[model samples]
Target: MSLKGKVALVTGSSRGIGKVIALKLAEEGAKLVINYPVADEAESAQQVVEEIEDLGAEAIALQADVTAMEEVKGMVKEVKQEFDTIDILVNNAGITRDTLLLRMKEEDWDAVLDVNLKGAFNVTKAISRIMMKQRSGRIINISSVVGLMGNAGQSNYAASKAGLIGFTKSVAKELAPRGVTANAIAPGFIETAMTDQLSDKVVEQMLSVIPANSFGQPEDVADTALFLASEGAKYITGEVIRVDGGMTM
Candidate 1:
């Protein structure tokens, strides 16, 4: 399960699940490029970079808005300058703009789609050229169960995540011949800053429905990401692996 000598780029890795993913990959001996949008806290991103370095894996943090193609291109360039080649890409940067369809603003819808779906597209597209040249790569997109089973007050978020699933399958087919694998992870109710904002009653009610009867930690998602990025998952692609504590079932 070691990724010795491999280089990975994890977007939105400043904190939460993304941060844990980067750390877990580093623990598995992968050099990392941590990407965070301008809106993310710099301290958190830097902390991740330092933590990876402390673990004896090389790591660098780069700021870039994933929704912007040019920014994503620049981010890839920076990563190339640092690691020369990227063997893995984790499209973990995403945002939720939760609102009922009737109340969802155009800006909210566009913003969520732009960052969650288009952002993955921008970063993956930029890195595909390098991966194609190398004839090997792994792409893991962070999707959500809400996308699979529609949730109330999250129309925009659901649409964005659902789009990722379609994009993952399409890209996997396109890159399969090149020895590249693309997949999506649909996580449900992971404990993070984002979920912390949920009302206490909402969280309680949600937990009651989960078979596990508990919320998932960031490491659970990170472990899944690490496996998908490993050699063990080479034969698996164009698929969505749920890390939902059986909630989706």
Candidate 2:
């Protein structure tokens, strides 16, 4: 196992892309800290923990709103107490409030920014301290292709993701000397509940832009994350790897 005995913390990992990332890390023998935002998601989070345990890997699910600094700090403290070290931190907690700028409400912008951007800020701020002390860590932020190539109805989402890229670069510079690498994965449209809701026509339209002629699976992103979290990528940092299947090419 490439990550045997390592401890990995992936925020908002109860389901979706975050869930897949956590599972992949666990498969590599990394102990998992699966974080969800609220009580309602506890069952789902526990299921992920159970799944990891079934895979013969240790895991615990912690609930913390990534946007809340105090909660984030507490989660970090708890994680340290349990695992003694956090080798990988995946800031995958995010939300989208899509609307054209003219139709966007203040609350919509605030909500998206708080979760997608501020949430990363809060979690990274708290965890980076530990990584700096250890003199080694991997910080992977989940960005989006929309951030690189603007989308008509996703101004807030695009801004948050773009800001995340900038934030990753800055953190990479600050932590490089400590052997910590910070990178962002800008995923294009992946098959998820969000995409499942689209009509066939809409799906075809989306596929048309993707030269691969297909939507990416969550595993594609998860695999990339696994590589980034491994020793193989120790020398790579401050970069954004686009898993867009040529959608933005």
lDDT of 2 by residue, 70-124 (tens): 9999999999999998999999988877678999999999999999999999999
Q: Evaluate residue 12 in candidate 1 and report its C-alpha lDDT on the 0 to 100 scale.
A: 94
TM-score versus the correct structure, for each prediction: 0.98, 0.98
Clashing pairs in 1: none
Query: Clashes per prediction?
Result: 0, 0
Q: Report residue 138 deviation for candidate 1 (angstroms).
A: 0.3
Per-residue error at 241 for model 2, in Å? Answer: 0.2
Whole-structure CA lDDT of model 2: 0.94
Lowest lDDT block of 10, candidate 2: 193-202
Off by over 4 Å in 1: none
Cα deviation of 215, candidate 2, in Å = 0.4
